[model samples]
Target: MSDVGDCLFCKIIAGEIPSKKVYEDDSTYAFADIQPKAKVHVLIVPKRHYATVAELAQNDPAELSHIVGVAKSIADDAFHGAYRLVFNTGEDAGQSVFHVHAHVLTGEVLAE
Candidate 1:
C-alpha cells in the first residue's frame, strides 16, 4: 500500500483523517466531503494514488472503474436517482487534492 504521507485522501483511507465514510472495499472508499457543495456530496477514491484523471494510466482502468462504480452506487443508494459525478483533472479544473477522486454531488442544481 502507498504511504499516507501528505495526501489527505490517503490519510482518510488509512484512518488518520476522520471522514463520514459511506462505502469501502478492498480497492476503493467513499466518504462525505468535509466541505460539501450540496445536500449530498460524497468523494470516491482509490486506495492507490493516481494524481489526476489526466494522469491515470490505461493499465489502471479496473481501479478507476471500481472508484467510479462505488461513486455511482452511493448516488443510487443515498441520493436516490439524482446525482452528478465529476472528476476534476487538474488545478485548472478545480482539483484541490492531487489524489484522483470522483465527486458525487446532488440535491441541488450545480453550476456548469
Candidate 2:
C-alpha cells in the first residue's frame, strides 16, 4: 500500500480536493475524470489507498471486486450497462495516479 497522505485519489476521497462526484459509498468513490477519454469517463477508486490493482487484489480481493461492481453500476446508469472497465497498473501504462482505480468509460462505441 502507498502513503494515503500524498495520493491524489485519497485526497479527493478525503474531501481535501474537489471533484465532480458521480457515486460514493462506504468503500468506494466515483468521480468524473479531469481529462476524459470517453464521453462518460468516471474513475472508481477504493477509499483505502493501494498503489496498484495487484496490490489491492493481494490485500483485499473483495474490495477489488467491489470497485468493479461500482463501475458496472455507473455504466448501467449511463449507457444501459455498455461500458469498458480499465485499470492501468504502472506509470508506463498511463497510470498517472499511483492509487488503484477502475476507469469506467461509456456513452459511445469504444474502439478495440
Stretches of candidate 2 above 4 Å error? none
**TM per candidate:** 0.85, 0.95
Top candidate, metric lDDT: 2
Q: After best superposition, candidate 1 residue 27: deviation in angstroms?
A: 0.3
lDDT of each: 0.81, 0.91
lDDT of 2 by residue, 1-111 (tens): 346788888899999999999999999899999999999999999998889999999999999999988888889998999999999989899888899999999988899
Query: Which ten-residue region of model 2 has the weakest summed lDDT?
Result: 1-10
CA shift at 48, candidate 2, in angstroms? Answer: 0.4
Clashing pairs in 2: none
